[model samples]
Target chain A: MSPTPTTATPSDVTPARTGGGRTGGLRLTALHTRAQLLETVRVPIAVIGTVVFPTLTMLFFVVPQPFADDPAQATAATAQISLFAVMSVCLFTYGVGVAEDRALPWDSYLRTLPVGAGPRLAGRLLNGLAFALVSLVPLVVVAWLLTAAALPADRLVLTAGALAVAALPMLGLGLWIGYGMSTKAALAVAQVLLLPLAFGGGLFLPPQMFPGWLDAVSTWLPTRAGRDLVVSATTGADLPGTTWPVLAAWALLTAVLAVRAYRRDEGRRFR
Target chain B: MSAPLVRLAGATRRYGDVTALDGVTLDVPAGQLLGLLGPNGAGKSTLLQLVSGLRRPTSGVVELFGRPPWEPAARAGLGMTPQETGLPPTLRVREVVDVVAGHFPDPVPTAEVLERFGLGDLARRQTGGLSGGQKRRLAVALAFVGRPRLALLDEPTTGLDVDARHDLWDAVRAYHRDGGTVVLTSHYLEEVEALAERVVVVDRGRVLVDGSLEEVRSAVPARRVRVRAAALPDLGADRALVDGDRHELWTSDADALVRRLVGSGAPFADLEVASASLEEAFLAVTAAADDRSGSRSATGVPGTSTPTTSTPEVAR
Candidate 1:
């Protein structure tokens, strides 16, 4: 028996047409970002690793620090905790995920499509931000109950600002790791980087607890600056003005490196 | 012709020490189904990537729809189902198709694309759980969702069963019927023989043959017949012969020799006839080139190392 050809009425099938310039780029970027987010957030490993891990570490250490006296120290500790969450989610979560994805052929496949490097990077940034947001839930709840940490109106805005700025460099760091390192090496390197960046940034302990030499070095690090900014914003405390510039510099430099690594001849290994 | 849907002018790609595609030039006319045939390292995949705009050529240029293939307009007009099993395993079959469709400027409805590919029932099932053949089918369905002007499929039927392969072939026929051009590379000669209007054969970094099926076959030497006869015949006694066998008959012309056997009343029981297939012709061409290459290397002649075999011309 011959198969019958199906004819379509105009209503059954939409006519294909060119999307306008802005609409096309935006829609493509949205699709790419959504896919990136879903791919990351849907995994149980990411949820446990990003959201739960940082909260668990904070509860173990911060629950013991008394909020009764020296409220300034209590506030400083809260800022440090928030920075820890962002670091784990943005750098650790995003890095490992993108590394595995790079190994699996996702970049090659997306590059073949109409998706550009900019939109692809944007989608990943948005996904990292979303994951970063979700990771804050436990930290916020735990900090409010245990410590004298309260988010004031302006403080909340500052926290938002810190997250936005901090995401830029972490996103760049994650992409660089994804494109620059081999899969096995990336996992090991991410673990190594995650621990030092988190612990040394005063996530486990305050920066003041460090020796003079270490504290000086920590301030120069992106993690230390990020934690300082978050703590200062969340609490009505003043941090050094140098903190903002340092974080910004890290963001800009890492972003350039990430883009360079992505387009590098050595990065085209999936084929 | 208005313009070829895909055109390569001296396109070349190389890895540090190895060349993938070397100065390949070809035009895939609009609405023509062109097949790319080659072995694993024959550079067919590289050629497909160049045409699909996945990578820029190391030298020369590749154009699609009369523009650089990587441009947004050109990309929107092209669709590719890559050789690697690259789809995210966590995504549902339906979501995968829908997501790929969303990348296009104006894509076909997701429901129609799914139903057409018989993937409606598997819509909610995750990609990881799908069988290999099912995943391949999903990849193909995703490529068609955009109604792209040019579809580049690399080893599209690798894991398909017979029925699935046939189903895919039907979909391809339907796609071509809609006036879309297709450039497909596959190790499956039968698939190429069935689907492609024109075939391009690549060996190493160069094109060994490019023409219609008949033209390729004509370029190949005539099929040498081998028959296990009770008694063997003498050379020139059978027209033309390189060697003979006591119980084997050799001839380029099978039918003429078969008639002669009946006329001369030769006793024969166990008889077998072997004809050269596209695969055989491909191997013969490549092997001969290798022989010429070795000979040139031995004599230390740099320019004459690569043998150039002209394909038999076909009158249009």
Candidate 2:
């Protein structure tokens, strides 16, 4: 027979006195974030893909060119790639990850639990930020080794702060796509949208080389606005007058759409 | 006395044009092992979802521990295994158990849970690499990790082998012995027979019968008659289910039918009569309920009648 002492009866496993208080909720959120990070890290290919794609693009396209020897041009290229890294994390983590989770039965089980959505949503946001940060490491290393990209110590910190703020619209857009479509559809859409946004925002080539019509439109895009902000911080370039308003507008719109998509999905599936 | 662990009063859930659960009322007392038996689209999953607060009803009320089931506090002592669950593929079995167990205040240890479910060896393996049967076992085991007072299992052993099913049955019985309330659904009649103390038969979004297993069996008025004859005998039975040369009949009045059979002096060599099994009782209950609904629809009777009280029914 088992010799474990019976110190507590089944009834003693009653509801906790704290209920769903802030501390309990936060603790659960932390655990969820930790688990999600572990799952992502276990799949090394997923981590490598996000980091490698942008780093390779910088090596082949930016570092071998005459612009590699110019501090201002090299810094702009580095900033552009940094934005690319953040965008990739947002799209893959939010768009593909959310769609996949929705298709899972574990999602339904979690929805039924007493804990509110706060923990799970917060956990996902944290996971997205971690990947975004890791995604930048490769691009930074390549820039330092092969290109003349240089930033004052304070400007480097500023570039990071700007990068975080600039990633908001992309994260919102990812959430919108994730909640609005199935896994297969979300994956396709994320891929299809990635190239157009990257090219249109002058991420691969300098905005100075864009056609007149493209220059007019690219100035309004969230990606271009984000790039301009990052480039200005890192390269000491003058910030464009339209950059702040354009990025702010896109952030607001995407945030609204993301919230709407989430509510619509919840109403359709769980109500 | 305390309120029942789960209470649904006139709950109705509709999806656009489809009515998943129609004005249903039910009560599940503490420490009762209730089995839900029904074919597909019979509102079994919907009922469980409402009780677990995964889906809200369109009307009426669903309560857990005298509070709305949707309330976090009300679900603190509840555990559920849905019909289908896909565990996070990359996480190990042990990690999944630990993450879920962390949601509860006083959880059963992860190691003990894994051992009890025969998953001790697979604890370090990623869930995605596990076989279907192993995954199913893990899903069910997760329900007990929280040491919940009540567990709602929707088709818990649906995809398990016979041996696995029996092992799972023992685990369920052990949980019940420890004073846990359970409401489980299954399409397998044998599964219900083996474990259920109380059975509820649902059809077309309605509970056709609810009572002890014996009570449900007695509710059917038909008796099974088996006889051997050279050819088919005109025993004047209402319906016949035949196996080879033997004829099985369902008749309301078996004694009168048998008297006629003997008087006719037909070349019947062997005769046998026995009470109907639970399978037949289940079929009869569902059939009668279908007939009632069919006639009601034919008569153009609106389905918006007053909600019925939660009374155990011999027949719908």
How close to the true structure is residue A217 of candidate 1, measured as C-alpha lDDT? 86
Pairs with backbone N, CA or C atoms under 3 Å apart (clashes), candidate 2: none
Question: What are the clashing pairs of model 1?
Answer: A79-A231
Q: How many clashing pairs does model 1 include?
A: 1
Give Cα-based local distance difference scores for all models.
0.69, 0.78
- Model 1: per-residue Cα lDDT over B198-271, one tens digit each: 98887666776788866654455434455545564442222222223334332345677667766667665555
lDDT of 1: 0.69
Candidate 2 displacement at residue B176 in angstroms: 1.9
Interface RMSD (one decimal) of model 2: 5.9
Model 2: residues >4 Å from true position, as ranges?
A1-23, A267-271, B82-85, B220-316
lDDT of 1 by residue, A165-224 (tens): 765676778778877777787788778888898777767788777999888888878888
Query: Which consecutive 10 residues in model 1 chain A have the weakest lDDT in total?
Result: A1-10
Task: Count backbone overlaps in model 2.
Answer: 0
